[model samples]
Target: MLKTIFPAALILCLSAPVLRAQDLPDYVGSGQCAACHEAESQSWQGSHHQLAWTEPTADTVVADFDGTRFQNDDLTVAFSKDAAGYHAQITESDGTTTMRRVHSVAGIEPLQQYLFETEPGRLQSFDVVWDSEEKRWYHLYPDQSLPVGDGLHWAGPYKNWNARCAECHATGYEKNYDPATRSYASTQAEIGVGCEACHGPGSAHIDWAETGKPVEIPGVDAFGLTMRSTADSEGWIQQCAGCHSRREAFGDGNPVPGTPYHDAYRLMMLTPDLYFPDGQIREEVYVYGSFLQSKMYANGVSCMNCHNPHTAQLVAEGNAVCTQCHSEAGNTEFPSLPIADYDTPEHHFHEPGSEGAQCKNCHMPTQTYMGVDARADHSFRIPRPDLTPITGAPDACTNCHQDQTPEWAAQQIEAWYPDSDKRGPHFGTVFAQSAVDPAGALPDLLKIAGDEGQSDIARATAMYLMGAAADQQTARATAPLLRDDSPLLRAAAIRPQRAAPPQEQFQNLLDLLSDPIRLVRLSAAPDLLRAPVASLPPRIAERFGRVAGEWQRSLGNRLDFPETHLVLGGTALTMRNTPAAIGAFREAVTQDPQLLDAWVMLVRLEASVNGAEAANAVVEEALQANPGQPDLMAMQRELQQ
Candidate 1:
């Protein structure tokens, strides 16, 4: 059964417009840009961005496809190339063998993942990937033995190319999902991340070039470009962060190239799931969130300062990257940087050529992801072994010295730099302490939230945690932040107020419905759902309705995601629509059987509305899907009783 929860009218209104090649009229493609910019085109020829996604071809496909068999647990995939194309013969544990043609190849250097079309218009990234460096095949998740129906399976909802990856990997992409049919007719102007991905559509630029490069125009931009290179440091950083950061999209597909970061997406803060309490990269969070915590970002440094935007490589190799600004001959671009010798043995307290003396080894430690890809932390933090014991966060010092305790590392650091002012109160201590003693941590959290010196992301994180104990004190502390200049802070301030009274929620959040930033309006709209719209002024009621519609449209855009169905189920329950709620929850569990909460909700609704027989059936199905799960087992026992 296709459990389509959304109404036909709503889906039609909110669905992404069907965008084909002709629909993207302004997009002249990357080849158009190459005619005028030869140097940049040459640099980007084989760069990671250019090869992010490509059609599988002889030159493009680097994996061994000459009848090679790779085994992982009970699954064996035979790779071979025929006259037709690259093919994978996957043998499942249940003794079913399926032949799938390779539809596309993703990435290049460290690891390359192959995509296979599982169903019509649905491409799934295969779990088995090619390790380019070692020239071998390996499973991305080696430990897990996922069944065909599992959410984490290669062909499951979570690994769907249209929903999860297409926008980032391709240029001018649109995920045209039809909820009625639950299928994708996804389209992209270019196959891989191209010159137009960063610079916006190139038709106007080409026109400007052919017309003798006019200095001024009545309606067109000076250069006929959408995104200007003359933007400030923060502008440039946000442009890159649009794709690099871990974030939630506002609507279907990617936003236009020049859209402000907050307007297009909501950035994930320093949450424990994605980051260590001290704001170190704990997962594959890319670089934006960590970089936001750095002194380099605070001091007006951007991605182009250290990395060549064309090649996606560091401007200088090794310690020379840091010495560009940190050395005695400081960089002219950043005159505010103090001239200092940081690349010597005296500063590092290690042999000049040793690993310990490397700037990145101490400050920007690397964490491996995707089996073979090693990504570095971009926080550019000074080593602080002293706080590791208190915050339970990893320190760079003890990371290299596995045998030594954090206390031992702290003592060594103290001996080397006894008068270090860097050893001060850290937000990580407050965040860690909040887990065991939230009451004790509240005052410190309040202080951190209001601290101007702290990074905006860190401050926003502090505000988000205080929502767990949303009391009068928390409400009062966060009230001022609602008016903060930063959209991140303003959006985060809405979270702690979720527990406030209906009237309070109305009074506090009504103004934010019309906030200039889309993220802030989206954050505030849900909490204001309980507002007294009926008795309110006509203008106020209209404002609430408009913002609520925006929120629903945002939800509609991501209906392809199973987690979005969970949100829909909850929202339906809040509206007292039992049947709609049941339908949404059923859809959620149907799409991804591992959603325990959705199953529980569906069972409870069925019991209340349809009787114990229906509820018991749901329980049995959940138990079958998630075998021996304690919560589901308990539910099954309860149903049997």
Candidate 2:
């Protein structure tokens, strides 16, 4: 039903990470920086950064707000402007008076966000619609069937920018929403992102300039404080990826620019909801996690390698950017690409210079995130439409030829790559076999898991099959890959090990408890719980307790979210706190009653602690939740016996 596809180098930098106190500049504001750094400043001016926030003025308002009246069913909206400010008033079907003041315009072209200044400089996401067809203005949120009362709609607290969006978009922004007061007094160092934002406070740098002496500043060793060196590649990447990547913030934002990525944002792991089985982007995941999964990234490729960090521009034109490493013939260092006409359509099967012929179309196909504009996958994969049904990843073919079927895409692919071993040995044949007979595909799937040359995604997918197949060898082989450098590989490596490693894998489990990706840590947490605590080292055992406590406090009542409960439940069991474990498992069961794993674990925990009665009740609940899940039926029968 859903199309799933698997998944920037920028090199030019502005400020070096290492800087003498004298090298720093004072917080002269963007206007001051605009004086000397005119080029960079001008590029940013009128761009999204400059237009991040705009006052209600004729020049700023692009929408046809000149006495415009828009209606959706019984609800009517009237736009008006005055010397004081611009406002939109909506008269709901229930006679509700909703007055929305225009605070700022979000984006240009495809879709835009209209900000409503909830307080001074504190703008909140409000009901501004996009006219998709006319490419104009319409209410994007709150359909005629859905009322503002529905918490899932845009008007809800979850969508509030003050709490969610401001930190990233606004410069020196403080999300000063006090739950005690139930109000906000948010302020910013400056309106939009400025030089000081990424470079750290220039006060120390400026002080050194005036005094001619070295001085200490907060973030001197970071982007602004230090010099940029290739040595800090991981650090530099983490700094940009802090915002760019699809990950959860582990702590507030204290992690330094050069800090290890895992120390800052915890990357979310591959899950059925977040990703397709073939490691394609599924939901609204940010890019870093996906990009890191690419072979290009693993082999020292970085965001800066392709993009100018300051201007955020591509390093070169078209396919030329790719040719830097991938030559027309072959590279002396990495001889992957054969001698061929890459730019021509003979290789691509599309007209030259057309959008369809672009290397990105086949290699980096787009998948939509944030509900609107499509984001190109960074995996830099070779097109494999044939793997769509076999691997369950959306192929580049289905992406463009949406009207056509996967079978059509596969047929087209066969014509081009007739003798191509892109599927790697028995992958194509075995993967195809898996679709028809999963049992038959188990051996080849296990072999694929151990193939080092195979794409990490394909290997990961193989590991996933092992879990469904319940193969011990596949789980054992995957355990070592958890220590793999690529987060994507590490994330997938844990899938099969979910049940196999009980005590021997406790150290590995503890090691990943602090993984940069939440998905990996979350995945490992459950494994850790099932592991024998007595076999765990004192240090690792202590880490389990620490992480479990932290997870509990942060998760709170958000346990209603299945992900929250999963992470919490896993950590709870690892700490050997059975009561907390039972509670978390119960909450998980409550949220998704059909979660077979949760039901089984809860029944086991209840049986081990509160006797057979509680276990029987949990089994009964599991049965009620799922009509006839094989796992549940088996577990229920075992418990009854």
Give each model a TM-score: 0.95, 0.70
Candidate 1 per-residue lDDT over residues 300-334, each given as its tens digit: 99999899989989999999988989999998887
- Candidate 2 per-residue lDDT over residues 235-329, each given as its tens digit: 66776776676666543322323445554455664455666545667776767757766787667677877876666567899987776666566
Least accurate 10 contiguous residues by lDDT in model 2: 1-10
Which model scores highest in TM-score?
A: 1
lDDT of each: 0.84, 0.61
Q: Which ten-residue region of model 1 has the weakest summed lDDT?
A: 1-10
Look at candidate 1 and tell me the lDDT of residue 43. Answer: 94
The whole-model C-alpha lDDT of candidate 2 against the native structure comes to: 0.61
Q: Which is the leading candidate under lDDT?
A: 1
